[model samples]
Target: MAAAFDIGLIVLLVGIGAWMIVVRDVVVATIIFVVFGLLMAIAWVRLSAVDVALTEAAIGSGITGTLLLGAAARLKGADAGGTRLSFPITVVAAVLCAMISASLAAVALLLTYPAPTLAPMAMQNLDQTGLGNPVAAVLFAYRALDTLLEKVVLLLALVGVWSLAPDRAWRGVPSLDTTVPPSDILAFFAQILPPFGIVFAIYMTWTGASNPGGAFQGGTVLAVMWLLVMMAGVMRAPSISNVWLRWLLVAGPALFLIVGFTGVFIADGFLAYPPAYAKALIVAVEAALAVSIAATLGLLAAGPPERMQQK
Candidate 1:
């Protein structure tokens, strides 16, 4: 039954992908895209990759889908329907895509019976880091540089988004569409859900060393909760120029960098935590990263500034 279910899911996903491509309506396509993400999350879980599943559900589907839906809403009727490529160009593009897919399939099929992996080695050193979850150990201990760079990339992406603002509204408040009145239920959920969300986020962060959850997953939850509150008019979005907000925006990556440089003078070098304090430092970094991630994602979703800041 489980095998059948997995097969069915794969079929459904393929159908959804096809529908999304053929559906001319941006809104409908975006909805399908979200469903695809959710299904992919389930797929990841079935594969025993809970950490990936959480990230996929939160970032890939939830936040990214929201961003796309908002873009669709803001761009509704703005698409003048740009010129389509010539038949030959379209054929060429399709052929190239097919060739790439075929190459990937070939590579997968030709893999060694027992594919090479570093899981055993990673697990062996997991204790040294005092992290129970191999995924967390790999991220913060095995390849800390990559993790730090990833957070920096997110901040840079947020900055790129902010740069789109006009000179007049450069440091102003992001403009959310307030013309439509929010439903009472939304406001109610905004109030109640956030407390649970906050607790869950904290749990996810704290237990990440021993479980599948981590900073990005928890941070995304906080980000989504903040957006919900803003949508319900429970709180005003912060201005781009807000001092406190700016500090939060850089706190995660900045702290990560500082730790890296400190490592240069101290232990093994560059993000190397001392044996006694490895878990403690990792937790601290995750905490700071979660805050910055939440703030950055929330502001990114709120879009570029549209009006002057309120006094």
Candidate 2:
């Protein structure tokens, strides 16, 4: 029965994916893509990879879906018509791709075997690293340099977005004609929500050493809080052209790199924290990253940043 269910899901996924690609309405296609992502998440869970499933549900379906919908709205009424390939050609291409994928999967299933595992080695080093989760230990202690570089890439993307922001002098502060002033009821909710979100974000970051929560999860929660505040008009998106805002955008990655380099000078390896201070350092870095990511994502969603004056 389980095998039959898996095959049914794969068939459904392929059908929906094809429909999504051929759909003429961009908005409908985007919604179908989001549904495809959610279905893929369910498949991951069925395969017993709950962590990957959670990530796919959250980042893949949730965040990406929201972004795509927003982009579709922005592009509405714009020139959407384009060239198309013949249906027969598309069918042939898809068939060839599916055949290749099936062959690869068959080979993998037949040749795969139980291999020597690294769980024991990771467990042995866990005590020295002070991380209860082996994944956390590997991410922060054993392979921290790669994580640091990934953070740097996020920082670079933020900078690139800022650079491409519309000229502030010519555009000036954006008129908030569409932005409604917050009512007392909305303000009340905003006040009550942010503190709770902050507490949750801290909890996630601290508990990440032992459990599923981590910097990415905590950062997303922090972003939610910021989004709430912006929606309530308690805070406005800062102008990207501002020097201080730019600094805040890069602060997390800059601090992370400096700390990692310091480890190289002190411990003779990149990102190697002193044994006594590793936990504290990791916590600090995660906290900073959460703040930076929250700010960057909020600004990105707000479109180009603009100068705001006290009302």
Candidate 3:
């Protein structure tokens, strides 16, 4: 039964993905892309990668789809085509895609039956870090520096997004259509949904050390909730240059750096937590990271500021 499900899933993924590529309308293609991301998340789950599945569903499907829809709305009727692909170009593109797919499949087929991985060793050392989830142990302890850098990269990406704003709007709020009155359905959900969403995000972050949830997944949910509320006009978007906002944006990385440097003085080395305090420190880091990540993802999806800050 499982095998049959897996096979059907593979076919669906291929069919949906191909449809996305060939779809002419931008909004239609973007919607199909969201579906593709959801299917990819399911594929990851089938491979027993719950962590990857959560990330895929959250970022790949949710936030990315939001971004695309926003873009499509802003550029409505702007030269996006209904034209069919030229025969030769279409043939070439199809051939290239097929070759890439075949090569990837061949590589997978050629791998040893018992694939090489460091998972066993990672599990062996997980107890030292006192994390119950191997994925959490690997992310927050085994490769702490890499994890730290990942958050930093997210910050940088947000910076890139903000840089697109006009200089005069640098201190302004993202134009989340605050002036337009939200629909009844949207406003109703926006009013009631956030409290529940915030609690869920907290649970995801707190339970991460022992379960499949973590800062990234939690942050993504927070981001989605923020965007929803802003779009619904339930809450005004904050100024990009608000001091407190800036501080919240950098809070995670700053605390992470402080702890890492402290490790150089008191523990094994940079980013190292003493065995006795490993879990405690990791949770602290996770909490801080969730806040920063939430803010960053929210702003990124909101796009560059478009309205002047209200005095």
Candidate 4:
């Protein structure tokens, strides 16, 4: 029965994806894309990657879906007179997509005969970081530089988005639509949900050392809560020029860099923590990174500032 269910789900996913591609309406296609992401999350869960599943569900499906829906609304009727591809062009694109898919499948098949695994090495050194979760160790210790660079990239993306703002709105708040009033139900839920969300985010970050939770998952939750409050009009979005907000955005990466540099003098090299305080330092870095991740993700979703800050 389980096998049958999985097969059925895969069939549904393919069907929906085809529908998304064939459907000309942007709103419908965006909705289908959200469903696709949700199904992908389920697939991740079945693979025992709960952390990745959470991220897929939140950022992939939830936040992205919201952004696309907003865009679809604004772009309504803009595609009414858009040109359609010629039949030959459509066929050529289809053929190219099929060739790419076949190539990827062939590569996967070739790699499966002697499937590579990093579990052994990761497990062997997991204790060195004093982290019970091997995934956490890999992220914060074994591959710390990659993780740090990911955070830096997120900050840079935010900077790029801000740079796109017009001169008049450079320091203003970036929001989807300030004039769109929230429904009473949404406002009430926004007010009621943030406290619980905050606690959950903290729990995920703290317990990540031993569980299927981590900075990214926890930060995504925090971002979701902030977005809810802002969208619901419970609180105003912060201005781009707010000193405190800017600091919050950079604090995590700054701390991570400082900790990395400290490793050169105190331990072996960059991002190396002494054996005794490895877990403690990792936790501190996680806490700061979580804050920055949340703020950065929220601001990224908010896009460039459109309205001037009210004095």
Candidate 5:
């Protein structure tokens, strides 16, 4: 029964994804893509990877979906159907992909390894790091250099976006169409939301050391808060071209890399901290990442950087 359910869900997800890819209406496609992410999360849960499922739900279904929908809205009625591939070409591509997938699956099933794994090695060292969760230990303690490099990649992406951004004079600011008075109920809600969101984001980041929460989750919450502030006319998204804003955007990843390199001088290896300070280092990195991610995602949603004054 479980196998059957998993297969059914997989088929459903594949159908939805294909539909989204081929749909002419961008908005509808974005909505379908969100649904596809949710189904992917469920599939991950069924596969017993709760952590991955949480990430898929948060980053995939939540933030990525929101980004896609916002972009679709902005590009509505734009030239959307310029490229076309014949049915024969698509069929050939599908056959090639299926063959590759089957070969990969076969290789995976045939692989053999020693028992009582390196996981135990990681588990034994867990106490030294002060992180209760082994995954967090590996991410922040054992393989922190990798995490730091990943942050660099994110920073590079932000830089690439800035480089591609239009000149300040040609850039347009996003406009909100609502007209709510200061004393209105909606205005009251808007005015009260930012602080609550900030509090929630901080709580999530602090709790991440021992819990399921992490920098990405906390950063996303903060991004939502920033978005709310912009929507409510309390704050405006900063221009991407601003030097100060660019520095702020890169600071998290830059700090992470610096700390990783500094670790080599302070401890046994690059990104390896003294056992006593691992937890603190992880928290600090996460905090910085939260701020940087919030800024990056908010700006991505805001489109091109432009000179604009908040009303």
Candidate 6:
């Protein structure tokens, strides 16, 4: 029965994904994509990867879907002039996609039984990191560089987005559509839910060392809350030129770099921590990174600022 349910879920995901591709309406396609993300999250949960499931639901489905939906709304009539692909070209693209998917499926089916894993190795070193969660240990100690580099990549992506802004609108405030009335349920929830959201974000960041929560998930919650407030017109979006805002955005990466280099002088090498201070340093970095990640994601979703600041 469990196997049957999993199979049904996979079929639903595939059908929705195909519909998203073939649907001409942007809004409908975007909604379908969001559904796909949610279904994927459920699959992750069933696989007992709750950390990944939270991230998939929050950043993958929530933030990304909201951003794409907003863009689709703004681009309502902008697709009228695009050139259509020829039948031959369309068929070629479809064939290429099918071949790629088939290759991946083949790889999955051919994998070795008992599934080689690093769980044991990770567990062995987990105690040294003073973190109860093996996943957190890997992220903050065993593979700290990989984690730091991921955050750097996010910052670079944000820079790339900002660079695309028109010169006239550079350093301006992001313009979000806030036409929703104050008495609407959206606005009411936005107002009432943020306090609880903030508490949840903090709790996730704090419990990450011992459980299936982490900076990314916590940061995503913070970002979603901020976006909600902005959407509800409870708070104005910060200008790109705001010094404090930029500092907050970079705080995590900056602190990570500082801690990384300090390790070289005091410990084994870059990103290494003394066994005694491992958990402390990791938590400090997570806290800072959570704030930075939240700010960065919020701005990224906001896209390049479009409205000039009023004098």
Candidate 1 residues 189-286, lDDT tens each? 88899999999998998888899998999999999999988877777888899999999989988888888788777788888988788888889999
TM-scores, all models, native as reference: 0.96, 0.79, 0.92, 0.92, 0.82, 0.94
Clashing pairs for model 3 are none
Q: What TM value does model 4 have?
A: 0.92
How many residue pairs clash in model 2?
A: 0
By TM-score, the best candidate is: 1
Q: What's the residue-level lDDT of 295 in candidate 5?
A: 80
What's the CA error at residue 215 for candidate 2, in Å? Answer: 0.6
Q: What's the lDDT for candidate 1? A: 0.89
Pairwise lDDT winner, candidates 2 and 6: 6
Clashing pairs in model 5?
none
lDDT of 3 at 155: 91
Off by over 4 Å in 6: 178-185
- Candidate 3 residues lying further than 4 Å off, grouped into runs, are 81-99, 180-183
lDDT of 5 by residue, 279-298 (tens): 88888888988888888777
- lDDT for residue 180 in candidate 6, whole number 0-100: 78
Cα deviation of 133 in candidate 5 (Å)?
1.6
Instruction: List the pairs of residues colliding in candidate 1.
Output: none
Position 232, candidate 2: lDDT: 71
RMSD list, candidates in order: 1.5, 3.8, 2.4, 2.2, 3.4, 1.8
Candidate 3 structure quality by residue, lDDT tens digits, 157-265 = 8889889998888889898877546666788899899999999999999999999999989988998899889888888899998999999999989998999999998
Which sections of candidate 5 miss by over 4 Å?
Answer: 1-11, 46-48, 74-77, 86-92, 107-118, 170-189, 241-244, 306-311
Global lDDT of each candidate:
0.89, 0.73, 0.90, 0.89, 0.75, 0.91
Compared with the true structure, the alpha-carbon lDDT of candidate 4 equals 0.89
**What would the per-residue lDDT of candidate 4 be over residues 1-311, giving only the tens digit for each residue?**
97887888889888988898899888889999999999989988877898788889988998789778866765785765478889999899999999999999998988965689998999998888999989889899999999999999999989998998889998999865445466677788888999999999999999999998888889989999999888888788999999999999999999999999999999999999998999999999999999999999899888889879878
TM-score of candidate 1 relative to the true fold: 0.96
Candidate 1, run of 10 with poorest lDDT? 177-186
